[model samples]
Structures are given as C-alpha cells and as structure tokens.
Target: MKKYPKYKSSGISWLGDIPEHWEVRRNKYIFQERNEKSVKGTEELLTVSQYTGITKRKDKVLGENKLLTNASSLEGYKTVHKNDLVINIMLAWNGSLGISPYHGITSPAYSVFSIRNKNENFSNFFHYTFRTKIYHSIFKTVSTGVIDSRLRLYPDDFFKLTTLLPPLQEQIQIARFLDWKVGQINKFIKTKKHILELLKEQKQVIINDVVTGKIDVRTGKPYPKYKASAVEWLGDIPEEWEVLPIKRLSKAVKTGSTPPGADDKYYSSEGINWFTPGDFSDETELRNSKRQLSALGVSAVNIFPPKTVYMNGIGSIGKVGICLDSASCNQQINAIITNEKISPYYLLYCIKSAKQFIISFGKFTTLPIINQEETKSLIFPVPSKDGQKVIVSYIQEKTEATDRAISRIEREIELIKEYKERLIADVVTGILAIRGVEVPEVIEDIEEELPEDEPEEIENKEGVE
Candidate 1:
C-alpha cells in the first residue's frame, strides 16, 4: 500500500490521478462475457432494481422460477462469485446496478459479468467505479441507436466504456474517503429533511386550528368560543361570517382544451408555460411544462390569465394550484374565472385544504368525478370582505415566508438525498468502500406490506427491498 495525497478539483476528473504504481485499462480489454440462458434452477434468485440495487432471490421476484422441480441440477443460470460486479445493463440508466459480494444466482435478465483480471486493483475498484456518474456517462454517451428501455446493455457497448484506475492501495483509500464524506453529507441532509417534516407538521397544525375554528380569528384565540348557528362544513363559523354556496359567488365555470400538437414549429422552448398535472405534482407550483405550445395552442385551448385558480379533476382529482401566469390546462381541469369577493389566495387555501372533502362526494368505480354542480354547491365560510382582506393578507405574508423557508430546506434535503444515493452507489460499486457501515437494521417496510397473495405464481416482478 502507498500513501496518496489528497488533491482537490471539480467533478470526478481528480479521480484519475491514482498512485503512480497502478495499471490503467478500458473494461473491454479485461473481460469476456458468457451469455447464459434460463433453464430449471434452484439458485436463490435475484432481480435488478433501479432505485435499489439487485435483491435476494425470493419466490416471484425472479418470476415463474417455481415450476422447476429438480433438487439441485439447474445449469442454465450463470454463477456469480463473491465480490464480482453485476449490473442490469438495461436499467443501468436508472441505476439498477449492484455488486454481489456473496456469490449468488440471479435472473437471466441480468447480464452478470465477472472481471477475469487476476490483478488486485480489479475487484477492489471495479464495483465502485461502474456505479459512478463518471463511468455511467462514458457508457451512455457513446451508445448508438435508441437504447431500448427494457433492453440490457449489449456486450459491445458495455465493454467499451472509459475507466479510471488507481493503484490497489489508493482504490481502497478513495473508496474510504468517499464513504466518509458521503456519510457526513447524508447526515446533514437527514437533519434538513427532519426539519422540513417538522415545519410541515407545524403548518398543518396552524391550518387545522384556524380552519376548524379551534383558533378563533375574531378573538385571536382558540377553543373557548362556540356558536349554535352553523352549516355542515362551516359548522359554527364565527357569527359575523357568512356561509354561501360557490354558485352565486363565481362569475363563470370554464374548462380548457388540449393544445395543438401537430405543428412542432409553433411550440418552442421559449414559450410561456402550459400547466398540467406534471406541474402541480407533489404540491410543486412553478412555471415549467414538459410540452410548451404556441399562440395556436393557446387559441385551441382556452388560455387562463395569471392568478387563475386551477384545480385538477380526473386522473389527479382535486389537486389545485393558483396559476402564476397565463397558461392552459387539459380538459381535466376547471379554471374558475371570478373576481367578486374572491381572494384567489383565500380560494386557493380553502380549496387546497378542502380537496379531500371535494372528492369525498365524487362518484365512479374506475374513475371519480366531482360534478360542476357539486363544485358550485360547495359551502364555504366567508367573513366580512374587510376580514377576508385582513386574513388573506396575513396568510400571504405568513405562507410566503413559510414557503420560502420550506423551499430552501427542501432543496437542501434533495441535494442531501442525492449525496446519500451517490454515497450508497459509490460504496456498493467499490469506487468508495466504507467498511462496517451501519444500515438502519429496523426497516419497517417489509413487515407492513400485505401482499395480495403468495408470490410464487408470477413472472417478472418488481419489488422494494
């Protein structure tokens, strides 16, 4: 083993400078692949996972391998030796790759390659590097033809990828450093995620208190004041407040059409956003659409101006967003065009908080529907316009502040999650090895899942480990 200096630079380029004694080589020059077929097998089966790496062979996870009755003579499945790297080349883009340190049997879908190199640097380094962003880029960038979503990487492309090498001693060292650094970043990210969860809980608490009248907006207090004169959803709203149906309140109920898509020239990357379910998923509200349409697209569909109250229906029923600018939604949405006594912000808060209620009365077996009449018949709590103004103003200031803080923390948490994923990827791949790392042993998931039936009868299964 040799002592290597800690050199700093951007990206993975600095990874190339290994200890002076190491041999460097492309993957193609070092290994030959044996493509195996599926026959009767008794190997504890394994399957490739994108979010998670390869997992232990269970009944259906290898899918339909149960028909074989042979005690131990299955020969079609290829054998993987401990510490040999195995990847599902098809799902590699999604990071469905892992190292099998315990020699095991896996599904024929996986292309199991054993590094034939007798050199010590090979095993110590190959597992880690294959999962790195640097190596993945090398493999993906040069592949010809449209890569099939389901097809595993061919031997040709798999063999041609660029590789970074280090002396046997440094391979171990780099892996160790990556392990330590990623663990630190992961801890920071976990802390931020916990804080975000706490903030969300606090936000929900405030919303429940105020909305449910547990906290009186009038007295600026809670739990003491009660009123007998109340409506169903608006039960016991402050006496001064008015309960009204949505039909009399709004100006018009309008829906949008799908934008024209035949003309590619009309739509460009620079056009204004076209709001869709993708835009509002997970409560994310910003101005970016997967597909942008032009003026024709806008005309073909009704274009909503900024500040429109957009609520989703069908597919993602009751999901709501206040459009920040002019945009159109598919026919699945109802954009209310109203201004009188309507605080878009207040309406937004009300609708978002009441989405479950909105969908509660909806009817359908395969698909649910919230009727326009039902939407118009929605009962709401209305304080004085002056009170509405005050509350809306208060909510704006408070929520904007909360949203900004939450956004910042959430972004940090995301970066941390990436770091954690990268850390795991690095460790499992052997690019950076962390010895004796603690895996949260008490995974509650396995115990909670109630499978519909015994899993022995299925073919091609996807599971979370």
Candidate 2:
C-alpha cells in the first residue's frame, strides 16, 4: 500500500518542499527551444498523437474526411529524434505537450527542445515531471485572454519550477512504470471521448427522427402541409405558408459598426451586453451577454435594442441568436428587427438550424464574414402563424433537453478527469509514497551526463536480464 504524509490534506497531497539539495525551476531555462525552423514538408512528417507522444501523421488519419494532414516535402523543416520534447504553443493550454519518441518533424507551432544534459536520473525524469497535473495547472492558470491561450513558457520559467527528483535508480524505474500507466489512462480517456462522439450521433439520430416527422411515424404522416412560395432557404413550402424575404418580414436589416475610438472603460464587465462574435454561445435568445459595455461608451457604436435576433457577420460568423434584453453589437454582427408576419421565436430557430450551412458560405481572409443578403437567403419550411408557434415551442423544448443531457454528461467526464489527475499526482509525488521509495530531492541545476551502470557478478537473480 502507498503511504502518504500524516499531516493530511485529505485523500492525497503528493507535493511538499523537496530536499535542500534540490530545487524547483521553470523549464525554459534548462533547455533552449529551437526556433528559425520550417517544415521540410517531406520525409515522414511527424504529428502529435492524440493518444500519446508521437506517431506518423498519416498513420492516424481515419474516416471519411481527412481535412488536416501532417504531410511534409520541404527539407528545411526541423527534425526531432527520439527523446526530444515538443509543445504546441497554441494548443498547449489544451494539454497538447508531449515527449517525442519517434523520428518526425513538428509543425512550426511546436517549440522543439534538445535535452542538453544526460543525467540519467533527470533526463527523462524532467519530461515525466512536467506531465504532473500540478505543474500544468500552474501553466494554465496564468494564461487568459485571446493571446493568453498562446502563452509559451521559455526555459527560464520552465527550469524555475521545483522538481521532486527521485534517486537515479528509482527515477528510471518510476519513469518506465508510470510511462505505461499514463498510456493506459490516455487510452481510457480516448475511449470516453469516442463514446461521447457516438452519443452525439445517436442524439442527432433522435433529432432527425422526431423533428423530421419520422418518429411516431404512422400518426405524424398527415400532420400538415403548406404550399410553395419564394421561401428564403427552402424554395417551395406549404400552400398556406407565406414565402417572403426577411427584409419584407422584419424591420430593416441593420448592421452594427464600431465607433472610431473608445477607451477600455467604455466596455465594462458590469454594464449592458457589449456583444461580439465571441460573446455568443447559445443560438437561442441573443440575451444580454456575460460581458457588458456601458451605454454611453457604446453610443458611438451601432447599438440595437434587445429582443431582436442577432446574427454574427464576422469571423466565426453566422451564429444566430435572439437578444435577451436591450444590447448593442459590434460591426461584425447584425441586430435584426422582425415584424409581426413571422414569430421571432420561429425565425430564431430557422436561423439557428441554417447557421452551420450558412457559415460554410462565409468568405474572407482572416475573418470569415457573411453578407446580409446571404443571411436573408437562408430558406426554411414556413408554417402558418399558429403552426410556427407550435413548431418553435416544440423544437426549443427538444433541443434544450438534448443540450442539458449532453452538458451533464460532459460535466461528469470532466470530474472524472480531475479525479484521474489527482490519482496521477498522488502516485508521482511522495504524498502517496510507494513502498520502499525514499524522500525526493528538489532539482536545483540541470546536470550534464549520467553515470555508467555498474557491472554485476554472475547470479541467477532472475530468469530474464
């Protein structure tokens, strides 16, 4: 049984100050990250293995659409030999860092490091050390904002963090043992992720069956029908339904533009919503956002009263939602005014359904943006005013139920992951000390080389070496 310190931080606290001889340091200073690199784009390019450290980029490609490839032909791209560490600066926040154990070239997104020293105890020891949850938690907590996600730790910061270094012999044993253990955990996590994907497909199947009048098949057949008119997205509709451009159906299509200059104070976190493409999450009510901008501050910008359906026209464009209350949008989003002809709720649902396809049509360099005309062109099956209400209410109830169920499952998975991290920390650190393990040393300096293994006398200690 593993023994933990008696001073108790509850179930497990794997960490404590190391021996006086050891030290905590940032990783960047101990090893220099290579730059001025380009992908040769050829000769067995390497890519991050979603499950492990390194794999042939093409080997992992599966299924119908292989949109992303790690193919390389250019020779200039840097090569990473076995035992090198690589971390994607952008995706690092998402736990994208891994040790490379195969011959491969990483994308420029990764900061490749060559281990300078070869202390057997600390070489791969540091690599596994970084995988500890406590270490990465420290890395992620400091990062925030758009660029915060891209925070890259240089060697200085990296080497500064303290390490609880085990003795040389134990280091090798622990590294090899935990390496296998981590691989198993990773496989388990991947299985959970795959199961989640299947659940989503199953849920979509449920939606298709019920929403398209497939479920309750016999009685749902003769539900209702409307005639074909010039519907926005769907050309023909029920005979009794009205087909009209959104322009005719609502107040003018008003696009919000930002005022020329404003201080950050104008965008207060506590005021009315100052929405942008990023602020929108739900496709339902555009309601006030978690983020707000002061009315006086946004006065120079295009502000729209709430209760209007909002569509993002900028990057991540075409997400449609209804505003919960009075709010203003930046130029990239359009605050739409709808008239009595179409129920706002119904229109929001139609837009929400079409948004994915509409967003696919967005065209722009950096920011994929959609024009008002394209948005208005989205077509849908129109029911009579009364039918519109029925369909809207029905779809809302169903979709929200699906969203809640999915969210609950996602939360449970997150908690499982947290528990898993705690387990790893307890094992890796001394808190849940494995039997026969000695107290750890906090590494202070990167060492240069490992001592040679001593020769042993002949003995039948084991059947295998």
Per-residue alpha-carbon lDDT of candidate 1 for residues 1-465, written as tens digits (9 for 90 to 100): 123334222234535444334445667766657565445555566655443344564522322323322224545766666665666655565455666656566645456776675564546356556666656665565544463333446667778764555555556655555445555665665567668778766665555556545566556786454664355554676655666667766776667666444356546577766665546633425467776777666666677777777776553467677767887776667776656776766676667656667766565432445656666777666665676676666655556666778888877766766766566454433344333444443322211111222121112223111
Candidate 2 worst ten-residue window by lDDT: 454-463
Roughly what TM-score does model 1 have, to 2 decimal places?
0.58
Per-model CA lDDT versus the true structure: 0.57, 0.55
Q: Which stretches of candidate 1 lie over 4 Å from their true place?
A: 1-24, 28-128, 143-155, 167-169, 222-269, 274-285, 288-304, 310-320, 328-342, 351-388, 411-465
**In candidate 2, residue 165 scores what lDDT?**
53
Number of backbone collisions per candidate: 8, 50
Q: Any runs in candidate 2 off by more than 4 Å, and if so which?
A: 1-16, 19-30, 35-40, 43-77, 88-96, 106-110, 118-164, 168-219, 223-236, 244-304, 308-323, 327-339, 363-373, 397-404, 424-430, 434-465
TM-score winner? 2
lDDT by residue (117-219, candidate 2, tens digit) is 5563345665656666676766554443334323665444445544565566655756655555555555555566666667656545543443232233234
